[model samples]
Target: MHRRASPGSQDHFDLFPYIAILMSLLGALLTATLGMASLSLGPGVAETWDMAARDGTASKAPVLVEWDGSALTVHEGAQRRRVPWLDDQAAAAGGMRPRSAAMQRLLAEFGQRSATGYVLFAVRPSGFATLPRLTDDFRAAHIDIGYEPVGQERGVQLLSAGEHP
Candidate 1:
């Protein structure tokens, strides 16, 4: 026979098991959240890189320069100076000589570093059509250079030797 409770009596139930299950679920979610947070991707995760020499000689730090369709902006650490675009007259010269004074001086400066360093051009989309011409001009002027395509408005930061990021 089963005993029945009186109408005035109260029945209490334990909630500890349910509470424990919820707590464990919360712990698992928190752990997953933290695990996902630690995994980073893209440019943000690209912090440091050790540059290797191309020719088995001592690797020279690259000179960072931005190329839009109009001009080349050289990045020397925190400093930046724009190298004016080739003028119509220089273009007409068939790469023999630059008519612009600024272009002449910049070329002269880069000419001396051909063997010691290389120019890394961050070419913008607008500069794509003129990239070959720009590279040709630099080559004609005896400047060693390589290029990488980048977004139009993106800014590039160059890391120095023995530096990170």
Candidate 2:
């Protein structure tokens, strides 16, 4: 049937209300998503981002920091060596030093071996708690450190040069 819309009469049902309702629902959903995103960006998050941004130097080798349930270790290239911590019972009670003697030795070794000035540090789950101080220590030695978190299954992830931190 060909029914024309008259001057003061309707030929079909008005869909404006339906469109308005859909728009309202979409607006509500958008509002919720934005609110959640804002909540996630806490004060600490911004500070951490700023800190990461400060280390803007391009990195080289990917070094993973690992903890084998007993000791802290480092995996660089194919070498997985134990980083012997000092006898500081209180710092970690678990006997893990944030800045270890073996680490200093490793730094010397890197100085002799690698030609690159930066190294990205990937931390194992067990070693994450000890990472902050260790990263700071590496920075103190003029080595750039970028964060890379290895999964539970992968003990150490050695990212290649083409890959990232």
Candidate 3:
């Protein structure tokens, strides 16, 4: 009978060992090409540079509010007060409900009669899903809330820092 080869006679290869090295090489090439392309393109526009309405919104600052998942806070000129933005904490929590007394009072302070009314919400990325609830709650009270719908970075920075919107 012919002698059979042992179980360890053949070597096994693991593709995973080379994956990182291959990826690193490809990524370096791609990154270098992108860098050269951007440099050739010159400085077009900065990511944070906004040249839209400068002083048109200076008449009055938009009403700003910050939501932190479980709590809501209103921003005045320089003061920030927590308000009860939810009618119930558990049942239908994110559902649109009547404003609480504290929230009503807070709104009453910034309440205005502009042709276009709005309430700015400085919300975290995590709170983005609940934004509809916040807007619905405000609109339910007859206050038109206008949001940028994009560039949430600036809003997050200003509103989260308690700055006047």
Q: Pick by TM-score: which candidate is best?
A: 1
Positional deviation of 148 in candidate 2, in angstroms? 1.3
Prediction 1 TM-score vs. true: 0.61
Clashing pairs in 3: none
Total backbone clashes of candidate 1, pairs 3 or more residues apart or in separate chains: 0
Off by over 4 Å in 2: 1-59, 67-71, 88-98, 111-117, 159-165
Clashes of each: 0, 0, 0
Model 2 lDDT per residue over 1-165, tens place: 998877788466899999999999999999999999988864434111111233556444445555533355676567877766444554668654554566678767655544554555555676677677666666666665577666545544555444454
Q: Pairing residues by index, what is the TM-score of model 3?
A: 0.45
RMSD of 3: 11.9
* Superior candidate under TM-score, 1 versus 2: 1
Where does candidate 3 have its weakest 10-residue lDDT segment?
44-53
Instruction: Give the candidates in order of TM-score, highest first.
Output: 1, 3, 2
Q: What is each predicted model's overall lDDT from 0 to 1?
A: 0.77, 0.59, 0.60
**Model 2 CA lDDT for position 2:** 100
